[model samples]
Target chain A: MISKFTYGEAELVTQLQHRNNQAFTYLYDNYSKALYGVISQIVPDRESADDILQEVFINIWRKIETYDISKGRLFTWMLNIARNAAIDKIRSKSYRNELKNQALPDDVSMLGDQFVKSKADETGLKKVLGKLKKEQRELIELSYFQGFTQEEISKGLNIPLGTVKTRMRSALLQLRSMIEQ
Target chain B: MNIKEYISSGIVQSYVMGLASKEEQAEFEQLCLEYPELVAARNIFELSLEKRAFEDTPHPPAFLKEQFINYINQNTTTNQSKVIQMEPAIPLAQSGSGLRWLAVASVIFLLVSSWLAYRFYNETITLKAELQHTKEAQANLGTRLKILEDYEKMVINPNVAVVNLTPMPEKSPASANIYWDSTTSNVYLIIKNMPKLPSDKQYQLWALIDGKPKDLGLFDIKDDHKVMLKMTDTRKAEAFAITVEKRGNTSGPDMDQLQMMGKTQL
Candidate 1:
C-alpha cells in the first residue's frame, strides 16, 4: 500500500527523476484515474484503454528526464503522453482487427456515453459537455481527446482549416470559463 | 506587441493543446520566455484543462498498480546495467585520440572566436554611426516641433489680429499675412505666396498709422511658409504693406514699389 504522503510538484519531479519508488507510487496514485479517463475517451474499449494507460505510465516513468518544467505543467505533459498512447493504439492495425472481431459499436458518441456511464463515477463532465454547442463539442472531442490534428479535423468535419482552429480555440475558452465558474 | 490581443488570439490555447504548428510553437515558446503574462495565461488554461480531466476521472483496476511496480523494478535493474556498460566504453574512447581531438578543437575555437570578434567590432562601428544619425534627426525634429508650437500659440492668441495683405496691381499674384499683437504691439509677417527675392534684395514691411508709413522690418522670401518673420512693434496701425527693397532696413516704404497692402479692421 502506498503511503498518504503528498509531494509538491518540484519535490515530486526531483524524486521521480531520481527513480524513487515512493514518488512513482504517489504519482500513479494521484494521476492514474485522470489519465485512465482520457485513455478511455479515445480507445473506448476498456481492455485496450487499460493497456494504453499502463503503457502511458511506463513511458512517463522512463521519460521524466525529458520533461521541462519551464515549458509546461507535469499534468499537461502526462496528458499528452496518455493521449498519444491511446491514439496510437486505436490507429494500429491490430486494434482495428480486434475491433472487427468484437463488432464494437460504430458510432463514437454511443460508445463514448456507454463507456463514460460505466466507468466514470461522476456525470458532471458529461453535463458540462452537453452545455456546449454541437460544433464546439465535436471540435473539442476530436482534437483534444481523440488527438486528431487540425487538418484531419477540418477534413473529417467538412470545415475549413481556419474554421477548425478558431472553433477549437473558442471551445477551449468556453470550457475554461465553465470550469472556472 | 499587443500582449492582450496575442493572448486572446487562441495561439496560447493551441499551444497548450499541442495543436499549434511547429513554427507557431517555436514562436510561442520564445514569446512565453520573454513575457511572463503569456506564461500566466498559458497556466490558467492548463489548469482549467486539468480540472476538466479530473471531473471525469475513471479509476483504473487496482491490480494494475502491482503490475506497474513489478515492471519498474525490472526496468530499474536493466537501466543500471545499461549505465554501467556505458561507463567503461567512454574511457576507452577517451584514451585513443582524445588529446589530439582536444588540441584540434582548441585551435579551431581560437580562430573562430577571433573572426567573430572582428565581425563584432565592425558591427559596433556601424551601429554607432547609425545611432549618431538618429540622434541628429531627433534633435532636428525637436527644434522644428518647438517652432511649430510657437506658431500655434501666436495664431491662437485672442489679442492677435490677422491681416491678409492683397497683392498690388503691379505686384499681382504676390500676397502675405501680418499677425499683429494688440497687447504687446509686436508684428509678425508670413509670406503666403511670393517669388524668390534676388540675393541682394529683400522685402520690407511698413505699418500705416493715420496715413503715415512707419518702417517695420526687412525679410527674405523663404521656401518654408511656416517661418514667421518678426517685425518692429507699433502702438497703432491702420494698414500694413510690403515693398521690394535692398537687403537692409529702410526708414519709409516706396509707394511705387509696394508689393502688397491690407487694412486693419480697427
Candidate 2:
C-alpha cells in the first residue's frame, strides 16, 4: 500500500524491521526490475544475473539494519549491495573469462544502451557523465557500472589506485559542477 | 587526514561508488563521523550515482520481481540460521541479527493471531449461552402448557355440572370444592383433590329419598384421583350420600357402605 516515493524513510525502515511481506513485496516490486537491468549489464548472462539478483537481495536483507539514513537513501544502499554481489560473482575465478568477452548481441545490447539514453534524456544522467573526461567515464563505468575493484581497475588500466581514485574524484566533481550549473 | 586533503584525496568518489577497500572504508567512515560536511558530500555523491544507476537500468518485467522476492525470502531463511549468536561484541553492521528480526516478526504475528482467536472464542461462548437460555425458556413454557390443558378439560366437560361446595373444614386454607349434577339419571362424578376412597371397590354416591337409598354411581380412588363417583340416577333425590361398595355397583348400599350424607333441599 505504501508508494515508494510517498512513503517516508523511517516508515520504510520500520516495515523492513518487521519484515512485513507487503513491504518486502513493494520493495522488490519497485526496485527489482531496474536492479535486474543493472545486474544484466554487469553480468551480461541472464542466468547468472538471475542468480546474483537473488544473492543481492539476501545481502540486502542481512545488511539492512546497517543502513544509516543520514548517509544515503535506502535505494542507494540496496543498489550498492546488488552491484557488489554481481561484481563478486564476476570476479570469481571459476567464472570463465569468455563470459566477460560475451558481448550482448547488438539487439539486446543496444536495448540497454537505448534504454539508458531515453532515461538520461529525461533525468540528465548522460549530461552528468558527459561533463566528465573520457578517462573519468571509463573509471566510473568500471567502478560503478562494471563493479570493478580499484585493484582490478588499476591493473586492467595499467594505472595505480591513486590515479584511478583521482580520475574518479574529478569525475564526480565535474558531475556535481554541471548539475549545480 | 586534514579535511582539505581528505576532500581532494579522491577517496570520497570511491566511497560513494562503494569501491573503497576495507581500510579506506574504515577511514572514510571515520571522516564521516568527524565531519558533517563530509557526510553531506557523501550523501550527495551517493545520490547522484544512484540516480545514474537507476537511470541506466531498464524497468524489469513485473514477473521478475516475484521471482526475486521468492528467491530472497528462501535464501534469507537458510542464511539466518548460519549467523553468529553473539551480540554486542560484533558491530551492528557485521552482527548476525537477521533471525532476530524474523523472531520479532513472528511474535507480532502470534499476538495478532491470538487476539483473533480470543475474539472468536468469546463470540462462541456468548452464542452458546443464548442458546441455553432459549432452551430453558422453551422447557418452562412446555410445563405451563400441560397445566393449562388440564384446567381447560375440567371446565369444558358437560356431564359434570360443578356444584360450588365450600370446604367442610379449613384443612386446606385456599381450597374450593365442587359437586356433580346427578339429576340426569346417568353415571357421573367429579372431584378435585379429594381424600382417597377405601378399596374392595370405592366410595359410592347415592341419592336418598326419605332415608332410602337410590343407586347413583360407583367410583374408584387410589391416590388423588379427582373424580369421586358417577351415579346411576339422581331423580327423586333429596339428598346425596357417600357409601362403600364392592368393586362393582350394588343394587342398594349396605350400612358398611355408608360413609357420609348431605341433605339437599332443592
Candidate 3:
C-alpha cells in the first residue's frame, strides 16, 4: 500500500537517515533478500545468515548517518556491512580455533553444493563456476566468497602471495568479462 | 601516482570486495573523485559483484519480513523516546557537524536538480525533433494532395478529353485509359490490365499526329496498384496507342506489338 512512487538511491538513503519508516521498509523489502543472499555465501549457514541479516539491517538503521554518497550506493554500503558481519561471524576466535581440529566445515560447500546439485542449470553462480578454470574458481571461492586475504589464500592454497594478488586481479577481471557476456 | 600501476595493484578489487582497510578505502575514494576511469571500474565491479551475490536469493522464509518489520516498529518507537533525551547531547555533536550536514544536503540537491534539468532538456530536444519530422511529413502529404487534386480537376473538367483505349482484337482483354487535356497537354495514362512484361521489355506510348507516330516515352509497371503517370505532354494528337517495345532505342512503334489503340473524338 505504501508503494506509490519509488525513490532513487540517494533520495532513499537521505529519507532513511531522516528516520523515514516508509523508505526503510521499501529498502528492507527490496534489498533484504539480496543482502541475505550475500550473507549466506560468506556465512554458509542459513540460520546464522538470518541472524547476521537481522544484525545488518539494524546496523544500517544505526549507522546510516555515516553513509556518504561519494563512497558508493546504499546497496554497496549495506553489502559491506553484511559481508563484514558475516565474515566476522565466520572468522571469530572460536570458529577459527575449532577449524584447527575439525574437518573442512560442512557448510563451507553447502551453498555451492545446493547450486551444483539441483540448480546447476541456473545461470548465475553455476555458469560462472563453469566458465572459470579450476584454479580461478578456487581463488574466487577462497578470496572473494570465503573471505580469505591474499596471505591467507597463499598459505591456504599453497601458492606464493604475489601470485595470489595477480591471480585475484586476473580472476576478478575475468569474472567481469563473463558477467558482461 | 601511476594510475595503471595503482589500478593493477589490486587495491580497487580489494575495495570492491570490501577487503580494503580504512586508509586504502579513503585513498580509493579520493582516486575515484580524481580519475573517471577508476570511478567507472569501481562502478562496474560494484555492480557485477552485487549482481553475482544477488543471484543466490533462494526464497527467504515468509516469517522474515513480519519479524523484521515488528522489530523495526518497536525500535523506532524506542528511538523516538531516546531522541528527546538525546536532545541535550546534540549540541556537543552539532559543532561542525550541523554545517557539514547542510553542505552535503545542498550539494545533493544541486546535483539532483541539475541532472533533472539536463533530462528535461534532452526530452524537449527529442520532442522538437519529433515535431520537425511530423511537419516534414505533413508538407510532403500536402504536396501529394495538391497533385491528386490537379488530377481530380482534369478528370472532372469538360475541356479534358477522356479516351478509353480498347485492346486490339488479337490481344487479350488487356485495357488502358488516357485523360488528355489539350489545353495543358498533360497526358495521363492509367494502364488498367497490361500483361506483366519481361524485364527487357517496356510499354511505350505513341501519340499519332497526321497518321505519324511520335514516341511518348516508355514506362515500367509501377508498384502502386493504381497509378496515373503523366506521359509526354503533346498538345495535339489525333490518337493515343500503347505498344510493347524494347527498353531503349525504339525507332518507331512495333506494329506487331500494338496492345491498345483509341482515337481522340473530342
Q: Provide the TM-score for each candidate, comma-separated.
A: 0.53, 0.48, 0.51
C-alpha local distance difference test of each model: 0.79, 0.63, 0.76
Cα lDDT for residue B39, model 2? Answer: 81
The DockQ-based order of candidates, best leading, equals 1, 2, 3
lDDT of 3 at B88: 57
lDDT-superior candidate, 1 or 2: 1
DockQ of each: 0.33, 0.28, 0.23
True contacts kept of 3: 0.35
TM-score of 1: 0.53
TM-score of chain A of 3: 0.80
Root-mean-square deviation of every model: 27.1, 12.5, 26.1
The sequence of per-residue lDDT tens digits that candidate 1 reaches over residues A128-178 is 666888788777766665666778767665779899778888887787678
> Which stretches in model 1 have alpha-carbon errors above 4 Å?
A101-127, B80-266
Question: Over the stretch B94-121, how does candidate 2's per-residue lDDT look in tens digits?
Answer: 4567777678789999999999999999
By TM-score, the best candidate is 1
Residue-wise C-alpha lDDT for candidate 3, range A35-154, written one tens digit per residue:
877776666557777778887887787778999888776778888888789878777765556456532453443323323333412434445756888667777776565676767667
Interface RMSD, per-candidate values to 1 decimal: 1.9, 3.4, 2.3
lDDT of 1 by residue, B1-266 (tens): 89899988878777876777899999998999899999999998888778888765667998898889887886787765574455455545746977776886899999999999999999999999999999999999998788678668889999989999999885669767888887888787877788888899888888898889888877777777544777656768999998888778555676788888999988
Candidate 2, lDDT over the whole model: 0.63
Candidate 3 chain A lowest-lDDT run of ten: A111-120
Residue B265, model 2: lDDT of 43
